[model samples]
Target chain A: MLLGVNHKTAPVEIRERLAFSNDPGVPYRELKAIPGCEEFTFLSTCNRVEVLFVSSKGDETERKVRDFLFAGSMSYDEAGKYVYLYKGEEAIQHLFRVGASLDSMVVGEPQILGQLKDAYRTSSDQSCTGVILNRLLHKAFSVAKRVRTETAIGSSAVSISYAAVELAKKIFGNLKGKRAMLAGAGEMAELAAQHLLNQGIAEVVVANRTFERAVNLARCFNGKPLAFEELVPELAHVDILISSTGAPDLILHKEDVKPIMKKRRNRPLFLIDIAVPRDLDSKLNDLDNVYLYGIDDLNNVIDINKSERDKEAVRAERIVTEEVLKFMLWLGSMEVTPTIVALREQAQEICRDEISRTLANCKDLSPKDQKSIEKMASAISNKLMHHPILFLKGEDAPEDQRRKLAIFRKMFSLDSVSRQDNGESD
Target chain B: MGDLLFKGTFLLYLLSTIIYSVFFFSQNKTVRKTARMFLLGAGIFHTIYLIFRYFEAGHTPLTSNHDIVSFFSWAMAWGFLSFRWRYQIKNFGSFVSILITLQLIVAAMSSSEVRELQPELQNILFPIHASIIITAIAFLAMAFCGAIMYLLQERELKSKRFGFFFSRLPSLDALDTLNHHCLSIGFPLLTLGMITGLIWSKQVFGSFWSWDPKETYSLITWLLYAAILHQRFTVGWRGRRIAFFTIIGFVVSLITFWVPSYHFTGL
Candidate 1:
């Protein structure tokens, strides 16, 4: 059983109250007493609060889990309006979709996969998840990987920082040995700086009007701090320049950049001015090898990327359906696999018993003749079992197949033997 | 056999032109690679055709307009391919292959019939002068293509709407650098070709500086390239300004090849 409140159904205000604590001990203890809940795990993220559990009571599990989540905060009837419940195959499909990021607000975003893995790890550490969930979550991870490779969902940039990295790629072609200069320590600039660093930029230069602030920002990024007056000379050494100074007058003008183009020997320079009043003059855009994008330009590119991702999301949804079907088929075969294994073991046991009886009665006969007779008996047993095994595994319609399996199990008394196999420890 | 090979080269270039245009408009990497392969095939056939024509003509096959045009087309294809390999600018071929196809078609249309050699054109230096000038034009052709791409990419960047042109064209720096590199390569070649022609004229016409129309136009083309290079190095004139002049220089060189020949009885 799976009970959850996602962005689609719940307001963030309520979600924040019911959201699970990062420490699993609180939620594990809280959910432990839910009647008939044999095992369980809690998944809480900014966009969702989901409780997945193994329960015998089916529909009642949803009520118990929801009541526990909103225990003293709200009444059952009030919280019920925000929660969605699923059971059996529906619950499995929901988990798969969430793990694959198909259910994310920004569909195909990669963060959800990591979050799901973190939840799985926490549940495993708490020993709250048993065999069924262990297999399901591992399978979900593989399905997510397949979705990532088989679709173009994660290839395009859909955020401001990602768009900045993409634009840098468009200008520099590669970022392996490039340098980035950050003119100010605005929040957006810091985010873009981190992205550039992740892309393998060799060094970073931080420049600001306030010397101590620049030094602080530089220390945070582990970059070199440049005096504000050294901005012109520093421009020659960097391939990417992001200016977000909050100055009324332009921090960068055409004349300041024009000479840098020559000193840089025509190497490309990508300028991103993300300041509110615009840190760089518009005229600086006309410089020969300098590519400049103001705040609106980056936002426009991000918008385009978002629309492109929305288109690819449709294709990603189809992949999810195909993967879910594959998982379901494998699950169906799981029940049959154990039954077939037990039946084969029972038949081989009967053949061995009869062969030993014949050998004891024929003790006066030659030893070689006794061995040949034993081999013959084993061959006959295998040939006799092959037909029944093939019939059991054949692709008949689901309803007819279930009826056939029941009759076959009863006629052969395989159910009693399977029950004994299960009771071995008992 | 010569005519058949020439036609084959012409048709192959036309096919590659279509392929490159498709690659440019669609911006698909697979189509770009396929177009590059088709171009390589065409270039191979073109080389074979040139060798065959050289054997048939008995001379160097650089004197007549038909041979000059064919040689020019081959040089453009070779130069573009080399640049594409070195720089990995696959989409730039869309504009350049079209230019190559047009040049080949003009070559196919011109008379390939071997005319009796004019007495003044029979010197060994005639082939040298023609070969250098044609090769110089090939380099200038690359510069010309780079200029057009620079303008288009600049327009897209300044407008702040990145569309097909923005995605397909190489960066502004790449195009500008290509223009500068081509000019550096072509200027020296042009100067050497003029020097060879000066020596040839002194031997045949008894005057190194003849006021012939061909001589005057070659001088004008040279001066234009020299000015472009000088401004680029000293005054830091680049990007759109340099691209515009490189394009103009290529057109004037074309005239120096075709128009001046009509003015002279034979040179």
Candidate 2:
């Protein structure tokens, strides 16, 4: 079962109230104290707080887990309004979706997968999860990997800084040996400059109105500090310039950049003007080899990228569904009833095949004789399957029951057909 | 045998062109590899065809309309392949293969009859001048392809449409570098080809300079490339302006090839 309150269902205030500390021990201690709770793993991220557990006492354990999560934040009825509960197959599907980042606030972002792996690691390390969760979590990790490889969900840029980097790549082909200049100390400019540096841009030059701020920002990037008045001269040296100054008017003009292109030997220049009242003139885009994108333009590119990711997300979701079905099949096989049914079906199939082949050879036989032969074959098959079924149904610990079910399925080769079926579907 | 070889070469080039076009749209890596293999095969077959024609005609095969245009196509194929060896420009082969196939179609349509060598044109300098000039034109043709891609990519970037050409074409910087690389090699060869032609003219026509239509147009093309190269180095003219200049220079060079001259009566 899975119980959680995420950004979609809870406000930040309510989410913070239930948010656990970073120390895994604290949450595990509280989670362990919940009555009737079996093996469990607790995941707390900025966007969600979820508890994945395996328990026979379903309703009681769910109530207790909810109380543990709420913990004086609200009444039980009010807490139910914020929390979502998924049992059985739904719970498994939810876990797979989360592991694959399909349930992320920013869909297809990679952080959720790492966070889930960390959560699973903590739970397994603390001996809080048993056979079911161990298998389930591993399956979830593989499902996430499959989704990542089979789709392009994580390839497109969805954030502003990433959009800038994508555009810069389109202009420069590669960022190595290229230089970027941060025209102001604004947060957005700093972020874009950082992204460029991460892309292996060779140097960064920070220029702001106040020399001290430029020096501080430059130090953060291990870059050069330049005076704001020298920005135009620096344009000749840099391939990308990000400006987000608080100026009411444009700081750079077409007239200013027209000459710089000549000085730079007509090398391509990418200008990102993220300021509200744009720092760079719109006409800068008119110059040959000069690409100027204002805030709106970058947002437009991000919007397109987001749509592209959404299309890929659909493919990712399909992969998740496939993996969920496969996991569900495995989960069903863990149960004694399914294993016994599969064993009987396999035995009957073998009997039918043998009887039909024998009847085909003795075509002179009467219908009554053929019917007698089919009855004898089924009786023998039933007698053969009786012991294995009894052994699977024997009363034992839940862990031993799982082991018996696995052994029974393997002995009869019952799951082999279903595995082949899955492969054929793929 | 020569006709059969030429037909085989044309078919191979056509097949490679078709595969390249398919790869351009699909962007499948396997398809791209297959397309490149077919193109390489076509290049080899074209080389064999040219050698066979040279042996059959018992003279350099750069004399007839069919031979000259086919040589032009062969030079383009090798030029493109050589560039691929150095650097990869996205979807470059697709565009270049289209040109090669079209040139072959022109060669196929024209007369392929082997012409008797003109008595005066029998000098060794004749073949040298023709082959060098055609090879130089081949590099300029690649520059022409790069310039068109540069313009298309520049339009996409400037318009911020992010449409079909945006992701498919190479970067503006890469395309510009392509133009620069091709021009740097082509212009010098073009100058040398022109100088050899002048020397050949002095030996065969008793004059160092002539005002033939082909000569006049060749000078114009050379001057245009010279101006473009000069501006690129000193004045920093690049991107759209350089792209346009390259296109114009290539068109003028094509005219230089087609204009009636004492040297090429096969047309």
Candidate 3:
């Protein structure tokens, strides 16, 4: 049973209360106690909260999770219309689509993909993802990659880092000679710097714990390398501050940046905190001209980009579907291959058996003659396999033979196993 | 040995064009594959033609507009091959085949009036100008495809006409990125070509600033392309609007390329 409310269903107020991440195993532990719940996963985001579980009693399991999430806060009836439910293959397809990021709030948003994988991994660690869900998740990832490579779906991610630079460009007209400072030189910080430099940012300052590594990284981007202690001093001069550091402690305390903020005399400062534990102080957002953006705040820009991406997505989808269908048809034809092999082996066994029997009766036959008969029998098998092998391979197949091969898959249990996967997984 | 193969290849482009048209209508994967293989084969044969023609002429292939166009189309197909391996864009082979075939037709028509290489103009810098310019145009062709796709995708969006292809196409982000990438790579190349062309003219003609039809048009085309690139990256213009400007730029290039040639007046 897959049950939840997202931006598609519930309002933001309900979604926020019900939103529960399972990284700490809190929701997973609580969910396992529900009656008839054999396996479960908790999917939580700013816009949606979903509970995917395996249960014969799908309705009861969904209700229990729904109630557990809300915890006697609001009436179930008020939330009922917003929440959705899916069971069996539909549930499988939903989860796969979600994993593929196709059903994401922002179509082709990549965060949900990593998040979904983490959720699946967490649930699997807790022994919640059964065969069905495991297969579904894996297939979803493959489809996501297919959508990425095959179709130009995610060809350009249009990430928040990109949008941040775009916003800066709108403010400054051009990035040439613009001063940019990176608080932490992590992936997001690097990406933001790269985006800035691509627009011709004149001077970029990298501030990190190890100044040597920072210097090395700065050289790659042709930027300045500054010590971590130099951050506040350098912050007053820089135009953009993107904080993405791995330190557990708060690197930029509110007071620490407040002095620099005042020293700049109301100069516009864009602070984007993409780090997981958030390097910048959130209170700094209240300050004037200090445009601070967290992961959630990026949704607005991401949504705009998504809408734009959604427009050109039409042709990409056509190309993807055509490729997907082509790939599926080719993949589906793989079932009869084993049968084709088996049949050839069966024919060869019969020939070998008969040849040995004949050899036993002719005791006067030399070893060389016996070996010749064996070779002849094997040759017969090889010759007979030639056509079927080619047919199975889509090689010069007569129209009817191709049709027969398709039929052969049906005759065997080819799709029964794969159809359960709904063509999402490998 | 190479002559028969080259002639067969020139004929093969005619057939390849028809095959590509069939694939466009049918959308048959097999037909598409056939068109791709055939185009690749034709490109190989055309390459042989150019190489042998270079030997036969006892000079480089960029002797006239005819050689430049043919050689440009060849390099363009090679560019497509490089992109096709990574991008795998559907129906591109069809589009590329039509483009290359049109170029081939124009080149073949002009092939009858081949001129011997002028001694003063036979420096390596001239070929550098020709090579960079042709390769830059190939990148422009890529941008052209991206623009076409952008318009089609935008029209589909405005119309809300979601169909089988509605989901398969590259997103606006992809198209815009592709367009920008082409401009970024092509712009420098175009600049280098222009600079080399100027140097070559100074060496051969003893003046860099003569407003020859080719020179004037090339500069005009370059400026237009430059404007589009500037607007896209700096002005944040994208999607349908950028598509219009990109095509406009390419048209300016084509006119500057084909219209002023002696083919129109001499014929």
Leading candidate by lDDT: 2
lDDT of 2 by residue, B34-134 (tens): 98999999999999999998888899998888899999999999999998898899999999999999999999999888778888778999899989999
The predicted structure with the larger lDDT, 2 or 3, is: 2
lDDT of 3 by residue, B55-130 (tens): 7777777767667787878887888777778766555666677787888777767753557566754788877787
Model 1 iRMSD vs. native:
3.2
Best by DockQ: 2
For each candidate, give the interface RMSD after superposing the true interface residues on Cα: 3.2, 1.1, 13.3
> On residues A346-379, what C-alpha lDDT tens digit does candidate 2 reach at each position?
7888998999899989999999999999999999
Ranking the candidates on TM-score from highest down gives: 2, 1, 3
Tens-place lDDT per residue, model 3, A350-403, is 897899789889999889988898898889778976875676666433333444
Order of the predicted models by DockQ, top scorer first? 2, 1, 3
Weakest ten-residue segment in model 1 chain A by summed lDDT: A417-426
Worst 10 residues of 3 chain B by lDDT: B258-267
Off by over 4 Å in 3: A1-426, B1-3, B14-31, B163-168, B259-267
Error of 1 at B133 (Å): 1.8
- In order of listing, the candidates' clash counts read 0, 0, 17
Better of 2 and 3 by DockQ: 2
Which residue pairs clash in candidate 2? none
Q: Order of candidates by lDDT, top first?
A: 2, 1, 3
* DockQ, each predicted model: 0.17, 0.63, 0.02
TM-score of structure candidate 1: 0.66
